[model samples]
Target: MLYWFLKWVAIGPLLRVIFRPKAYGVDHVPAEGPAILASNHLSYADWLFMPLTLPRRVTFVAKAEYFTTPGIKGWFQKKFFSGAGQVPIDRSGADAAEGAMKSAMKILAAGELFGIYPEGTRSHDGKLYRGKTGVARLALESGAPVIPCAVVGTDVVAPTGKVFGQWTRPVVRFGPPLDFSRYEGMSNDRYILRSITDEIMYEVMRLSEQEYVDMYASKAKELTKAAKEPVEPSDATSSAKKAS
Candidate 1:
């Protein structure tokens, strides 16, 4: 398969060597069965470095646009993402979240590790943003344990919108999996959704050790503005409001 071949014989070895990531609590990941890796999205580098640190094939739901375009870049995106096992999900409608959640559930149902950034988008300020309920929803519905992960130094290695930056080594830490079995059979409840999402974000915050920001990272702060302030939360809406 392309995935295994890439990991064992191609990209994976080179990535691990170049990234030289520092991992903590990797043992927290389940050795077998389906599970969800809930992580903070810090930068483009997070996409490159996180899964390399993991032994299993971890698949993230990438924007569908990445799979379509009109040039060499598009071709490369399709080839690499497909080879790396990422699924493309359209995030352009009210049902986008639900569709992505369904796709994630399908992965779990097939007994695979699914990666999700509960924050929904990259954090412009490297702060842990409020988490969307999709991760919680998937966990509730699919019975997958949620592992909290953080990729430090990504914001530095390749901060958003920079196009390119220094290839400094990044740090990746995997916290103990948060068991949501207690909330089993409670999917579709807003309160339960908020609670589980918050719980996962709390662990992410601890791992990243960044200030908490309740707003969507792209809001309140201009991702292209080139200036960022470290704060707990801003005037932006909650993750649920912003993500869905």
Candidate 2:
């Protein structure tokens, strides 16, 4: 109820008036059924604009800390995210992946739309990163089709690592549903998972027209951070200078 109110009545109309997001290929989404809407992660605003363009409510798992924070701010944060169709999940530790999969499977089982960023994390840069195989496993395990989606210009609306960005119209595009029934019951096969994930990423790349990076987004971010850190002089260098 809050979800509908926020989307159609409260926040949705305001966003529409301001940003005027456009959507294409929305017909690709099933009217009523379980489906994975696999998309590239460019910016945090991707979730807002993509779902705003759709009639159906799209649910995505967010870090539990968003809902668990203390005090008055946390209460509003929890309600806002919940109204925005986000569910909180603990994203820490080795079991995080399994926990997210279970949550997603439950949503699919209930015949609801489940949104996932196959890249696992938002791209620090605008390029599309290689997708993780969890999306493939979800599709295979849930017997649901995977719809490749791309949201463009969200980075302009809300740039990564920034609070807000200049207003610009965002475009959401949906590609045809990818049916992997041929690989049914083979979700455990690492090779098959890679194949399916790659196929989905290819579609996203095509729709978004972003450069494709073979590395995971998180790994890319780590590399970028490492590059920016100051390097210390080696002990050998210091000794040689002192001796000289």
Candidate 3:
């Protein structure tokens, strides 16, 4: 299969030679069976280095646009993402969340590893953000254990919003699998979902040693962008007039 070929034969070996990435606590991953690898989203490279260190293929959901774009470039993009163990999901509409949940549940039903970033989006400033409850919902619905994972230094090798970055060894760390059987059949309970998500994020924070931010990563990015935008002179003048 293209996935195995790329990981072991084509791209994997080259990355190993160049970056020499190191993995710690890999034994925490199950030898077999379904599990969720919940990790902090620091950089886009997190997916590459994290799965590279694992023996099993880890599947992550990507926006459907990546696969649906038209043209020659889109063809290659689709193939590359597919070979990298990414599946496409339409991340729009009211049913988007449900659709993603179903996709992940199907993977778990097949006894495969499903990778998720509970933060929902990559951190803009390398700080761990509040994890969304979808991860908790997935674990409870699928009856799969969650493995807290942390990948450090990926931002150095592939910084967000940049094409490429300096080479540096990235470290992937895995913590013990979190079992949520106690909350079985309670996935619909929003309070329980939030509690479970927070527990998982706590472990991720410990493993990554990154500052924890109570805000969502997407919101944090938005606020940061808003802060950077220069205020219009008219707006400034209006504000001054109102103050006077």
Compared with the true structure, what per-residue lDDT tens digits does model 1 show for residues 80-100?
888887887745446778668
Off by over 4 Å in 3: 90-94, 233-244
Worst 10 residues of 1 by lDDT: 226-235
Residue 58's C-alpha lDDT in candidate 2?
97
Arranged by lDDT, best first: 3, 2, 1
Compose the digit string of candidate 3's lDDT tens values, residues 81-129. Answer: 9999998864544577777887798899999999999999889898999
The candidate, 2 or 3, that scores higher on TM-score is 2
Point to the candidate with the largest TM-score.
2
Each candidate's clash count: 1, 0, 0
Clashes of 3: 0
Which tens-of-lDDT digit does each residue in 1-244 have in candidate 2?
9899989999899999999998999999999999999999889888888999898999998878889999999999999999999987645446878878887887899999999999998988899999999999999999999999999999988998899899899999999999999999999999999999999999999999999999999999999999999998899999999999
TM-score of each: 0.83, 0.95, 0.93
RMSD of 2: 1.8
Q: Candidate 1, which segments miss by more than 4 Å at Cα? A: 68-76, 90-94, 222-244
Q: What is the lDDT of residue 197 in candidate 3?
A: 99
Residue 128 Cα positional deviation in candidate 3, in Å, after optimal superposition: 0.5
- Ranking according to TM-score, highest score first: 2, 3, 1
Question: What residue pairs are clashing in model 1?
Answer: 212-232
